[model samples]
Target: MMKRIPIALYFLLAGLCAAAQPKKLDIVFIGNSITQGGGLQHPLEEAPPVKAWEWLKRAMPGSNIQYSNQGVSGSTTVDFLPATNKLFNNVVKAADAFKADKDATLVFSMVLGTNDSAIEGPNGSPVSPEQYRLNVKAILDQLLSSYPGCIIILHHPTWYSPNTHNGARYLAEGLARLQSYFPVLDAIVAGYRSTHPGQVYTGYTGGFSYFKKHPELFIQENGRSGVFQLHPNAKGAAELGVFWAQAIKKVVGRLK
Candidate 1:
C-alpha cells in the first residue's frame, strides 16, 4: 500500500510540473514608425520588438519566442481600422503566420497615437480623443473576434517634443491631445474586463513619463519648428523593449 501511494504522489507532482512549464510565445507587434524603429541604422536588429524578444530570451532561457514587427511608418489608429483593409490586414496575416504553432500562445503588442495627435500629418491627423477611443476599440474588437484565445496589449504612445514639426506638426496642443488619449486607453482596457475578461490588457505605459524626465533617450532631430525629439535612440529602444518585456512577462506569468 505504501509503494502504491508513493507512485501516485510522484505522478501528481510530475503532472503539476508539466502544467507549470511556460508556453511558447508568438508575439505580433503592431504600431507606427516608433515600433518600426524608424531612422535607426539597423532597424531589424535594434528595433524594440527584437530587443524585447532578446530580453525574454535572457529572462526565460530556453523558452521559445517568436515575434513579427508589423509597425508601419506614419500609420494611425484610423488606418488600422477594420474597414481600411490596409494595416489591419497585414496584422491578420502576421497573426495567421503563427497559427501553425499550436503550442505557442499568441500576443499582440501595440503602440500608436503619435501621428494621430499631429496637427497636420498622418492618415488621421488631429484625431479627437473620442474618435481615437472609438478607433482603438474597433481595432481591438476585430482582433479579439479573430483571435479569440490570443492576448492583446495596448501600449500608450511615448513622448514627443511639443514643438515637433517636421513632415507633421505636433505642437503643444498636439501634446495635450496625446496626453488625453492616455486615460481613454486605460478606460478601454478596464471596460474589457467585463467584456473580454482577461484577453485584453494595458502594457508599458511609462514611456511618456520616463522620456519626459529623460530627454537624452530621444534622437534629437531638426524639425520645421526647430530641434525636436520624437524617436528613441538605440539605448532608448532597448529600455523601451525592457518595459514591454517586463509587462509581457507579468501577463505570461498570470497564464501559468
Candidate 2:
C-alpha cells in the first residue's frame, strides 16, 4: 500500500495535466457575395455562405467549429467601419459578439476591394490603386485593434467576367494592380503575426493562378461555368475552398 502511493499521485498528476489543455477553436468567416455564394445552383443551392459552412463542417468534422458568415452582397472594405452606420452594423455586431465571447477563438477571413475597384468613387472617378490600398489598410487596421490575437486571412478578389467590358484582359490587369497592394497587406499581417504567431495570412488569387496552370481541375461539366466569370461556380468555389482549407490547416497545425 505504501509503495502504491507515489504511483497513484503520478497518475493523478497526469490526469490534471491532460485536463489543462486548451480546447479547439470555433472559426468565423467574413466577406462579400463570393463568400455568400452569389451564383451557381444545380443541386445544393447557390448560396456561398451555405456552401462554405457546409464545406467547413464536412472538412473539419467533430472539431467543435462554428462558422459564421457575415458576407453582404456588394460590401466594400470601406463599408466595414462606423459601427452605428446601418450599412455596416451587421459586420460590427458579429465582430463585437466574437470579441465578447471568451471561449471562442476568432478566425476572420475577408474578401473585399473588388467592389471598391469596380465602382466609381463619390467623385465619379474610378478608385485608384493607391486609394484601394488605403481602404484595405484602413479596414485591416480597425480589425487588428478590435480583435487582438485573432487569426485573420485576407483574400484577394477573384476574377470578374471576361466578356463584360474589359473582360478577362481587364481581370488580369486588375490582378496586377491588386498584387501591388500586397505589400501593405503584408505589413498588416506581419504586425499581427508578431503578436499572434499562430495566425494565418493567405490569398485565393494564387488558387486562380493554379486554375490557369491546371485547367482540368475545373472542367465544365453539366453545363457548369469555368473561371473568369463575374462569380465562381460550385467547382470554382470548391477549388478556392480547398486552397483556403489547406492554408488554414497549416496555420492551425502550428498553434500551441
User: All candidates' lDDT scores?
Assistant: 0.89, 0.56
Please give the RMSD of candidate 2 to the true structure: 7.4
Clashing residue pairs in candidate 2 are 36-48, 37-48, 162-167, 162-168
Consecutive 10-residue window with the lowest summed lDDT within model 1: 14-23
lDDT of 1 by residue, 1-256 (tens): 4555588898998666545646589999998989999978899998899899999888876578899999899999999999988899999999999988888989999998999999988887899999999999999999999888899998889998899998888999999999999999999999999988888899989889998888888889998899998999898888988899999887876775
Give the Å shift of residue 192 in candidate 1. Answer: 0.9
What would the per-residue lDDT of candidate 2 be over residues 163-199, giving only the tens digit for each residue? 2222212334444554555555666566666655656
- Scored against the true structure, residue 178 in model 1 reaches a CA lDDT of 96
For TM-score, the strongest prediction is: 1
